[model samples]
Target: MQAPVQRQCSHVSTCELFPKFGLRGSLRVWQVFYCLGNFEGCARYRLSCEGRAVPASLLPNGRELNIDALVGKP
Candidate 1:
């Protein structure tokens, strides 16, 4: 058996992470990772996508919402 290679994306995206702002107050780098949000019972499975860099204050007003209300949470 062998490990598979990852894919890349050429666009920006918005995703939800737990405890809202898990990496708050910082800029992120882009990569492919599984998000534990964006679906019902989000953590059970993986939501794969490009892990684009986002800011802690990326959300409006820079305040961390309990959940990414615009989308939803895990």
Candidate 2:
């Protein structure tokens, strides 16, 4: 009585989990993120599968990274 793979949602828009199978009941790893938009292109913000050390561009508004939103203690 389990769900199908495609129907599963182990990944979040910000970060994702590996092991497409066991991911059903496991904690996801922490992957730090940088600003998405840049003077170049959005693809530049994309992370590599290897998770290598790459320089990322930081944004001022970061319209996405609303630190206050993350700290949901209200």
Candidate 3:
């Protein structure tokens, strides 16, 4: 018999298949990143669904996260 399917949550934190999808919307799209190490320490780095733009505070390890450079022309 075939196994039953499961539904995934829209939230980035609780979902395991988050990487398979892009953080897309009418204003902007963001690449979903999963922190493999130190989940507690990297809690602040997780992207928030509250805004269209990528927050500078979400930067991890002082690395430059340029959203404009990553976005493609529509």
* TM-score winner: 3
Give per-model CA RMSD: 11.7, 11.6, 9.1
Where does candidate 2 stray beyond 4 Å? 1-4, 7-45, 48-63
- Model 2, residue 73: C-alpha shift (Å): 5.0
What tens-digit string does per-residue lDDT give for candidate 1 at 1-74?
97765443222244433224345433221122323212322221222323445443333223444444424445
Clash numbers, per candidate: 2, 0, 0
Candidate 3, residue 47: CA error in Å? 11
As for model 3, its CA RMSD to the true structure in angstroms is: 9.1
Clashing pairs in 2: none
Per-residue error (Å), model 3, residue 60: 1.9
- 12 Cα displacement, candidate 3 (Å): 3.2
Error of 3 at 2 (Å): 27
Q: Looking at model 1, report the run of 10 residues with the lowest lDDT sum.
A: 29-38
Cα deviation at 48, candidate 3, in Å, is: 8.6
Q: How do the residues 1-74 of candidate 2 rate in per-residue lDDT, one tens digit apiece?
A: 87743322222343322222123332222121222213122232333334643222312222333333333335
